[model samples]
Target: MEGIDAQRLEVKKERAPKLPVHIAKEVTKGRLLKHVEISEKSVLPTALDMYREKVDENLKGEIKTHDTSKLRHAEVVEKNVLPTSVDIAREKVPTLIVNFDTEKLKHVDPVVKIALPSVNDVVREQEEFKAGANEKGGMIHN
Candidate 1:
């Protein structure tokens, strides 16, 4: 043992009662009898699951009772269904039609045509105005 090198020593591992290759492979892959978490809640059936028909009947009864109560409350407050004074006033107030036809607008009167003074004409007028201002001791507008 002292003379044998640890790295050179061979260790043999064996499984007693040899398993079939397919089953061994499945066991190795964790696909055979896999582990599962079991709880009481998960194992037991819920009220709805165990008594679906009874639960459905109970739910329908509750819904009918709720609807009847709502109807009775609505009947008590039925007068509020009528429009208020403000609502009546708003309805009476006129609303102008805002929709317009582009075709109708195209056929409308042409925009007022005004001739704009040419650039040269405007320059000439400004030159004459400046000369007049100079002649008037720069008090033309004053």
Candidate 2:
């Protein structure tokens, strides 16, 4: 490994990752870490002086991705790809397959005429007309 001088590293004050303003001004002097902590292990910082500019580009890319996702979500709503009011109404209220309009609904004809027996017919049909009241007040017919 080649030895790198820390004194030669340059500070980029304009485009550092968003940090609290109350931090020490000296802390801002050396933007690149001498040894960065990553995955529980300390690693050497990059010699690149333009780190802040690269980070700004990354942030811009993320912003563009977020905006694109929002546009795709809007497209799903604007197009009929997602279920709409009409689709929901049609699903809820189904159309009747049997049409009553312009077509006669055949009425079920009821039994209008039934043969009823008269008093003469009932008396003539009876072979034995003997009827008397029994001891229990119920009539017995023969």
Candidate 3:
């Protein structure tokens, strides 16, 4: 019998690995210096001096003697404005109820029923987990 001829195996080609992206260094100090230079050049020194003078004049005018007696009288008036009877009446008044459509009421039902776990629930679960772990003598994985 003639010897069978063997076929040459073809090699599979692979995609090349992607190269890392290059980022340029940020200009921090240079940008800050440029901003400062622009602000200095944009404003006139004389105008800035005039502004400072006006601000000082305004500040001087604003400093005046406050009448403590008048302030005390005003505070007394404000404190005494509310009557005890009015407060009692306000407390006795029931809250006003606004009725809405049945469909709107139904929409609010699920939002109200979403059973948000309370503080007690969270504490109870945590204690249960700790107790279970202690009993097993190992940390709970889940």
Name the TM-score of candidate 3: 0.21
Q: Which lDDT tens digits does candidate 2 get at residues 41-107? A: 6776675746977888999998877855446433444555788898887776544444336455677
TM-score of 1: 0.21
What TM-score would every model get versus the actual structure?
Answer: 0.21, 0.18, 0.21
Question: Which stretches of model 1 miss by more than 4 angstroms?
Answer: 1-111, 139-142
Candidate 3 clash figure, as a count = 0
Write one digit per residue (lDDT tens) for candidate 1, span 76-137: 54455888999987876564234444555455676998999999999999889989889888
The true-versus-predicted C-alpha distance at residue 54 of model 2, in Å, is 65
Tell how far residue 111 is off in model 1, in angstroms. Answer: 4.1
C-alpha root-mean-square deviation, each candidate? 19.9, 28.2, 31.2
Instruction: Name the runs in model 2 displaced over 4 angstroms.
Output: 1-98, 106-111, 127-142
Q: Model 3 over residues 28-104: C-alpha lDDT tens digits?
A: 23543344443445655798899999999888776655444555433444455656997876766663233334554
